[model samples]
Structure formats: C-alpha cells, structure tokens
Target: MRRLFTGLAAGFLLLGTAACGSSDGSGASDAGAASGGTTTLKVGVIPILDVAPVYLGQKQGFYAKRGLKLQLIPAQGGAAIVPGVVSGQFQFGFSNTTSLLVAQSKKLPVKAVANGVASTAEDGADFAGITVKKGSPLTSPKQLAGKKVAVNTLNNICDTSIRESVRKDGGDASKVEFVEMPFDQMPAALAGGQVDAACTPEPALATVKAAGGKSIASNFFDVSPDLTVAMYFTSQQYAQKNPELVKRFQEATIESLKYADSHPDEVREILTTYTKIPDTLLGRLTLPRWPAEPDRASIERLARLAQQDGLFKQSPDLDKLLP
Candidate 1:
C-alpha cells in the first residue's frame, strides 16, 4: 500500500494557503488578547467547504476578535491529518470521523470537541460515491467484484463506506482490489482507465461526473445517518492546557458557519483563493453542513466500525477523548 503522505508536501504547495483563512500569529483582536497575547493555533484542513465556518470566522474577524492567531495547514487527507494532531504538529486538525475514531480506538489519544459536517443527499452535500466511466457496463456495486477501485486511502472512511456499500448490495468486498489515488489525480486516472471505479468527495466527485462518469453508489448518509463525516480534533493535552482558547476557537468557527450559510457566493470566492479548484467547480460542489453541537452517536458508530475492520482490537474509553 502506498503511504498517503507521499504526495502531501507537494500537494500542499499546490493548494497551500492562498485565499487562506489561517492566521499568521499576529495579535489583531481584543478577544484574542483576552485568551492570550497571541493564542497561536496550528490547524490541518482539507480543501473542501465543510470547514467553511472556520474560514468564514477568519474572514469575518471572529478569530481576531477572540485574539487567536491561526496557522492553517492544508492536509492531504484524514489519514495524514490524524498523525499531525497526535504528534502536536497541529493544535487541532480537521478529519473524517472514521479516521479519528480509528486512531482513538487504537489509543492514539485524541478528542473531537466540535461538530464538523454531514453528507446528506441534499443538493449541496458533498458525499462519497463510486464513479465509473460513462460507457462502462458496471452500473452497480455488485458488478465491481474482482475489479480495481481507487480511494484516498485504505481502511479509512472512503474504503469503509465503499466496502459497506458493496456488502449491502451482496458483493464480496475482499474480492475487489483497492487502490490509492489522490483527489487531484483521480480524474485523469479514471479517464486513462487506470481503475474501474473511484470513491471521492467533492469537487472531485463533480469532476468525475463532468468527465462522463456515472455514480453507482453514494454512501454518505446511507452508511450512517446523521454521521459526523468530518470534524476538528485535538490532543487531550492541548485541551487541558488551553481550554479558553479552544472555547474561543469553537465560537469563532460557529460564527463563521453562520456567515457562510448566508453568503454562499462569497464563501466560494474565499475557497478559490485557498484551493486549486476553480470557482466554477466550487459552484457545482456539494458542501457539508456545519453544526454547533457535536454528535456523540455518530462518533460511537465510527469506533464500532473501526473495531470491526480491525483498525483497533478493543474500544478505547470514550471519556478520555471527549471535551
């Protein structure tokens, strides 16, 4: 299996903080001074709009008002982001619930304190789906047996969702081959016929759809209804050391979400500044909802799935990982 971080450093350069919502450690707000002279927050994020609240907060001066200086690191995927938080490279990182739950189940020591986003079948909700070439005979998950499928990573949300989706359709997941393809490369890979199917999130999903590919299965809500698909997670040590900062960060992020909800076009403009994806693609992308309250049940289901997949042999105590 190819390590997910292989292309991350270069990928970061391509999509690194241009229209960034990240702070540069400068003290610019009264709320920030109350927390500390400069409450520096290093964050890991993917390019998708689920973290729009954080970006909105940064743009709207919420973080500044709280006196927090945020340094945003655009992570390659959930697998790479989890290690960054566990090792203290980032005070907090955005990740899919599956990856964080798996790490926590295996004793990596992390906690998810805020709600992220959920992928419903709504018009703008970005979820994972199996995409095949337009003319391919494979139109259903059951037809994927013994074929190659690409995911951002194996043993993570993309893979877990794909597998569960196949099982639901009476297909043997073990009989199929899983490949690792980054979001940027998936389109070309599919166009070149490198893989029969690809599992991805938007705007990559939109990219595939635009490339004349068809979706066979979409499992964002089906696999786990009201699931906390992705969220902001941190080490317990950070929370213990900076409870006030964490609270302020959450407040700023929530405020940002509200702003983005009211100003979708402006948020898309902000996204183009930070991501390699163009504004037109951003317009077609499906974004997740930013909730204020963290959902405990969705997180618990993540732990259970991780154990079932052998990502962990035993369940880690949930109390140690909650705020």
Candidate 2:
C-alpha cells in the first residue's frame, strides 16, 4: 500500500523556479550547478516496490557518480506527480504507463525516459491481484458484477486490469463499481465490508492476504501479460533540453534495476528505507520484473488497452510519447 503525502504546493513553487533557472534556453540540460557544482534533479515517485531501483540508485550513488543529485519526492499517485513534472516542479516523475498516456493524449508535455516495472508469470510472483475477504461468497470475477471494487486510482492500471478481468470472465464490467482508495487502506476497507473486493498491488496484496484477504484473480494475467506496468518520465522540454542528463538518469536507473533483479534481499532491504512496510513483511512482498530498458512494444500494447477501455478519446501518438 502507498502512503500519500499532503503538501506539495510550496515544494512545487520552490522547485519550479530552480528548474526553470537551470535551463540555458538551448534545451540542452535540465541539471544546474548548486553550491558544490553538482546538478540537482528532483523526481516525483510513489513509495512502492516499483520505485525500488530509484531508491537503490540513490543508496548506491549510481546517480551521484554521474554528477546528478536525485531528490526523490514521494507523492500519493500519478495524479499528483504528473502535474509536478508538467509544471517543472519535478524534472522527472515515475508513474504507470496508463497515466502517462492519458496525460499525453491530453497534450501534457511529458515523455517516458526509462522503464519502471513489469509483470511476471512466476508462481507466487503475481505483482497485482483482485482480492476478496476470506470465505467470501464471491469466488470469481463474475461475482464482482454489481459489487463495489476498490482500486488505488480510477482509470489506471488497477481499474483497467480488473475491468478486463471481469469482462474476460463473462461478467458485466460496466456494472462493477470502482471506488478510489489508497492501496494501504484497501485491506482494512475490505475487511470492514466497505468494499466487495480490491484490485491491489504488492506489497499491499501480500499485506491484505496476511490480513485474511483471498485472491479472486490475478490482475495481470488476462489484461496485461508481461506488461510494462510503469515507467519513469520527464517533460518533453526537459528531455529535449537535457538529453545528456536524461541519458545519464536512464543509465543509472538501468544499473540499479539490474542490481535489484540480481539481489532480492538487498532490494527488499533498501525498500524499507523508503516505504513504511515493515522489514518482516518485506521478504514476503512480491517483486516486479525490473527491466533494464523500456520496451516500446509493451508500452504500445498498454496504450492500445487503455484506448480500448475508453480511457482515451483517440490512440496516443506513440512516436512522440515514447523516448
């Protein structure tokens, strides 16, 4: 479950000025010299397992070695972070592909910079699942019709996947009511009879199961197979103005992703430093597939799915959206 931060206006204002001042009018770089001549880049991210590589990069000095100082700012969801990136408050942001595509369709000047997370088919490694209370009468996605389902955000990955899952199961996807709730609060909400089911992502999925929630369906199984679930993005201006900085950021991120892929224990240990998830539960949390580079095909597949789900008026211009 993700914890959302409250105040960002003040931070946005302060950072926006800094970011604009750093640009030299040539679209050559987003990094600017601070007190010690180090370039500081503020990044907006949700505090989840998907962002583990970002934390790992910081902890291991992968970005610092490239003369980039990363300011990892946490937000509740993409709704908050996308605006920060668009307004120059954050030089870059991490969000799901669905949110970014929606933003791009609406003409938000953002381009994906790096891969964030992906899904896998390995047993016990389902990163997201639709869960119901233990021994609930709802045994399958079909039963979810006319029932209230909780998701971290509306019209994003969780909601879209669950809707598709229901449709694939011969359920009336349109009848399934989707309620917006934070992943962290979903378990309690489910247990309290507030929501019939929850489309939850790990480690919230793990936490909910520990609290007696049972999985009805794996969200990724039907809607998105080996999907590129999330990605790191920056404004179009930032990418064009600072290609070198973006390249360096991508390099550091890929290195961290590879490191995290090979070292699960270390990744979990680093995750504790950013997320409030307890150390004991970290071992049980399902980890996402951390790709070394963003896959255009997977992203295009997601865009098509989002379009088919009515999330967009028209297909997003992948040529311009992908970086």
Candidate 3:
C-alpha cells in the first residue's frame, strides 16, 4: 500500500514538467521508437471489470488495425496511474471521475480521452455496491456511519461515492471511517472482519457475494443514475504533442467500449486473459455499462458531491478536462 502513495508522489517529483522524459514531438516512449516498427503505447490500468473493454479491443485487433499496440500495466489505482500518465511512464491511464477531478483541481496536466465505464443504474443490481457480511445486522447505507468501510483508495471515487450513498440515506458521511485496501484484498478483509464493510466492484464483488456478503446499497447509482464512473485519459502534454496517435487511440477505444458493451460473453472470456477471476464467478459478476462517451451531467453531479465531501481544493473545470 505504501507503494501506491509513494509511486504517485514520485510521479509528481519525477516530472517537473509534462515534457520531462520526451525530447521530440512524437510523444512516445523510447521503446516505441521506429526501430520496433510498431508503436506500442504503455497504459496504466486497474485490474477491474471496468477495464475489460480495452483488453477485448486489443484482442479484437482494434488498436492493431489503427497501427497501435497497447502494453497495459496493472496498477493499484489512480494514485499510481495518474502520476504514471503525467510522468510519461504510461502514455495513457484509466481513472475514476472523482480522481480525475481531484487531479484537475491540483492543476495536473491531464485530460480524459474516452468514457471507460458507467453504472448499470439499477437499484441493488449495479456493477459495484456497498456490501456487508450476510449475517451482519447492518442493512442500510445509513449504518455505515461510525463504522469502518474499505475502499481501494481514499478521497477518490470509491470513498466519494460511498459518502454520497451514506448522505443520501440521511446519514452523516463524515462519520464513516474509510480504510484503504486494494480491491483484491477487500474480500478477505471483509470476511475476516478486518473492516465493517467494503465498496466492491466485480469480480471482487462477485467473490464477496459468493461468500454470502449482502450488498446494502449501490453507491454509483445513489450518486446519479447516469454517473460516469471512470474514463481513459492521458497527460495533457501527451495529448497535445501526439495528436494523431491520440486520435487513433480515441477512435480505437471508443470502438472497443461499444464492442464490449454489446458482447457480454466475450467480455467474460476476456477476463480470464488478464485476471484470475474464476469461471463460476464470471457468469454471476455484474458488468458495468461501457458508454462511448461520458455523461457530462453525471460528471457534474459528481463534482458537486465531491465539493460537498471536500475532496477538491478548487472547482473542476469540465471544459478543459473532458474530451
């Protein structure tokens, strides 16, 4: 967990400027040189169901057809990926809306390129949920107050959305204690009573559910039925310098998102390629909505909720942030 914060801090320190590592206008890694003949771009991604589309797209040759290749690096969360993208360690990254908003508030030179994922918007049936052990007495989001809740990262999307759920249930969100744990570790932690609850997304959500965990609320749904949970992004410098490559990436990604949205079985099969999610759970896990573009209204609503929760130091400028 220390690596999560350390890597982000290092990213900020390593890249004093957006053009720190690059010397020319191609805005590519040294490995992506002409010597290789194929432009392979590194992208930092989280190991979650939300990122399944890009993998599917890659397998489907969307990026290859665009004369690009992806080297997806599994990151703990946006804490690392944000800085990785900004520092040029990754040409692109996947991050939640609030974390991107928080990065924007800090004046980080980053911009979202395409929609990553969204909520199913079905009450108690969304892709991610706030879950407690089945035998636990807690049956509502309001009960999260005065209890410890585990989130992948603190002050980012997981906690921010959970706070909204608690507040919507008429509970004081501030009273909730958020414990920082990786998504993979959450199932065991919740089962062992290491935390009172967890904000889990599939297939971890599926694992917890298989363990008899009962979801009390759909946090993303509680925030907004149209909430744009996450998106694919790149450093502003990378976007500015590599306009053509970025355009190719955007086109490929949007196609990938659309393809994944319509093909559920392919997505389940692709999960086996990068993650260790079991076959039995794959059939039961709820997949997120993959919209070709983000919902600006939902993002705006999240910005307002982030403000209410004190996650941002300054207002998020959507015009410059969104694609």
Q: Choose 1 or 2, whichever is better by TM-score.
A: 2
Better of 2 and 3 by TM-score: 3
Residue-level lDDT for 238 in candidate 2: 76
What ranking of all candidate models by lDDT puts the best one first?
Answer: 3, 2, 1
* Candidate 2 regions with alpha-carbon error over 4 angstroms: 1-36
- Maximum-lDDT candidate: 3
In candidate 1, residue 156 scores what lDDT? 75
TM-score of each: 0.84, 0.88, 0.93
Give the clash count for model 2: 3
Clashing residue pairs in candidate 3, if any? none
Q: Could you tell me the TM-score of candidate 3?
A: 0.93
lDDT of 1 by residue, 1-323 (tens): 12433433433443334314222222223345564575678788987666666876787888888777678888667877776665556778888877776667656668886767776645224455688877888987877789998877666787777776777789886677889867767877888999998887766777787778867887665466666787787777666666777788877776776777677677667777666676557767666556666567766776776666566676867677655
Misplaced by over 4 Å in model 1 are 1-36, 121-126
Quote the positional error of residue 217 for candidate 3 in Å.
0.2
Poorest stretch of ten by lDDT in candidate 3: 23-32
Model 1 TM-score on a 0 to 1 scale = 0.84
